[model samples]
Target: MRITVADPAVPDVVALLSEHLADMHATSPAESVHALDVERLRAPHVTFLAARDDAGDLMGVGALAELGDGHAEVKSMRTAHAHRGAGVAAAVLDSLVDAARARGCTRVSLETGTDAYFSAAHRLYERAGFVECGPFAGYGEDPHSRFYTREL
Candidate 1:
């Protein structure tokens, strides 16, 4: 798989992001859904990534939003449903962490849903050295949210 910064104007990227957003809303409450929309992902502070197969089919997506102060937040992570369990999410995640380290971030964190829909994400983060942590950045304590952080 090839991972690169996603172009917001690309149709495939747009559709994949739409699917991702629908999944988040399907599993989490409106207030609990932290996934960024295409517009937010286009902000200068965010670096959105897309993983694609050799044929250029989008397989997964993730983003790292620079939070300043040596910290960054992982955002909008999702693997194509058809590609689940094929390691696409892990690859995208590893690349985002690498991007964080390259940008001089000391810690990277994320806010994900606490529901069963997030189980795979929790497992992926844990295996990659992330640990449960209190919310960082502007986030507050919420029953529907689970936070994790990892030091680079």
Candidate 2:
């Protein structure tokens, strides 16, 4: 699979991201859902990425959002259902981290749900070297949110 910068507005990309947002909202409280919509992902501060297969099918999508102060946040990470368990999320995550490092970010952080619904995501971040931490990037403490950060 190839991972590269991509536009969130693309049809398939939008569909994937819509699924991501829907899942987030279904699993977390409205106030606790931080996943961005397609328009927000297109903001100038966010760099969206897509992972595609050899046939160019969208395998997954992820994004890096600049948070100033040499820090960045991972956003909108979702592997297509068909590609789950095939390392699609891991590959997309690695690419997002690489993009953060390339932008001179000294640290990368992210927030995921703090519940059984997010168990897989928790494992993914931990395996990627991210450690649990307090909320950052203007986020306040929330019982439903689990924050993590990794030094670049």
Candidate 3:
């Protein structure tokens, strides 16, 4: 797969983001969900990355948002339903981390649901060197959420 910084307004990327939002809503209560939509991903502080297969099929997407000096948050991480377990998400995640590191972010953090539905992501982040932590940036403590951070 190939990873590239992308324009969130692209059609396929927008569709994937829509699916991600739907999944978040279905998995977590309204107030517990933190997934960002296409418009939100376009914010100036955020950088979007896309993963595509050898055939150029959209495999997954992930983004990093500048929270403040030397810190960033991972946002909108999602592998296409058909691409899960294929390393697509991992590739996108690594790209985001690399981008964050390049931008001088000393720490990278992410928030995901605490439910079983998010176990895969929890494992992925753990394997990528992220460790569970208390809420960071703009988040508050929530029993339904799990926050993680890693120092670069």
Candidate 4:
């Protein structure tokens, strides 16, 4: 798999992102969703990444929000359902963390649903060294979700 920063103009990345957002919404209530839409991902503070197969099929994507000089948040992480359990999510996440650290971020965090549907994500984050934490970046406590963080 090839992982790299994405150009929002690309249609495959856009379609993959749209599918990812829909899946997130499907797994939980809209209020519990924390994904960034394409328009929001175009913001100056966000960095979007795309992972594709050798033949250029979009397999996964994720984004990082630069919170400040040393803080960042992981958002919109997803892998195609057909590619689940193939390490696409982990590859994307590892790359995201490396990029964050290179940008001088000391901490990286994420908000994900607490429902059983998201158990795989919870485990992924934990294995990547993220630990449970109270909301950061002004996110108030929400019973529908859990927050995790790690030193980058």
Candidate 5:
């Protein structure tokens, strides 16, 4: 699979992000769901990426948002359901980390759900070297949110 910067407005990417938002909302309270929509992902501070197969079908999507002060945030990470166990998320995650490093970010942080529905995501971040941390970038104490940070 190939991973590269992509436009979130593309049809397939939009569909994938829509599903991601839906899942986030379904699994968490409205205020706890922080996944960005297509328009937000297109912001100047965010770099959206897509992982595609050899035939060019999108397999997953992830994004990095520059937070200034040598810090960045991971946003909208999701692997297509059919491609979940195939390392799509891992590959996309590594790419996003690399992108963050390239942008001179000294640290990368993310927020995910703190429920059984997010067990896989928790494992993924931990395996990638992210450590649990307090909320950052405007987020406050939230029982349903789990925050993580990794130094680049």
Candidate 6:
């Protein structure tokens, strides 16, 4: 799969992103939804990417949000339902981490749901080197959330 920073106006990327957001909202009621809307992804601090096959089919999407001072947050990670378990998410995540590192970020963090619906996400994050942590970057403790952080 090819991973590239994208302008949210790209039609394929926008459709994939819409599906990603809708799936997340369907899975958890209390997730700290990231601001992945088109304009938000174009913000100075955010770097959004969409993963695509050679044929141009979108396989996954994710973004890295600069939090300043060598810190960044991972956001909007999602793989197409049919592509789940096909390494699409892993590829996108690895690219996001590399992107953060290239930007001089020393650490990367993320927020995901803690409900049963998120167990798979929690597992994936752990496998990717994220460790459970208290809220960072202004997020407070919330029973509905699980926070993770990793050194880049």
Scored by lDDT, the top model is 5
Q: What number of backbone clashes does candidate 3 have, counting pairs of residues 3 or more apart or in separate chains?
A: 0
TM-score of each: 0.97, 0.98, 0.97, 0.94, 0.99, 0.91
Q: Over 4 Å off in model 2, which ranges?
A: none
- 7-121, model 5: which lDDT tens digit per residue? 9999999999989998998999999999999999999999999999999999999999999999999999999988999999999999999999999999999999998989999
Q: Candidate 1: misplaced stretches above 4 Å?
A: none
How far is each candidate from the true structure, as Cα RMSD in Å? 0.9, 0.6, 0.9, 1.2, 0.5, 1.6
State model 2's lDDT: 0.95
TM-score-superior candidate, 3 or 6: 3
Decoy 1 TM-score against native: 0.97
C-alpha RMSD in Å of predicted model 6 compared with the true structure:
1.6
Pitting candidate 2 against candidate 3, the one with the higher TM-score is 2
Clashes of each: 0, 0, 0, 0, 0, 0
lDDT by residue (1-152, candidate 4, tens digit) is 99999875588778878887888788778877888989899898888899989998888899999999699999989897778899999999999999899999999999999889889999999999999999889888889889999996
Off by over 4 Å in 6: none
Each model's C-alpha lDDT? 0.91, 0.95, 0.92, 0.90, 0.95, 0.85
lDDT for 127 (candidate 5): 97
Q: Give the Å error, residue 23, model 6.
A: 2.9
Clashing pairs in 4: none
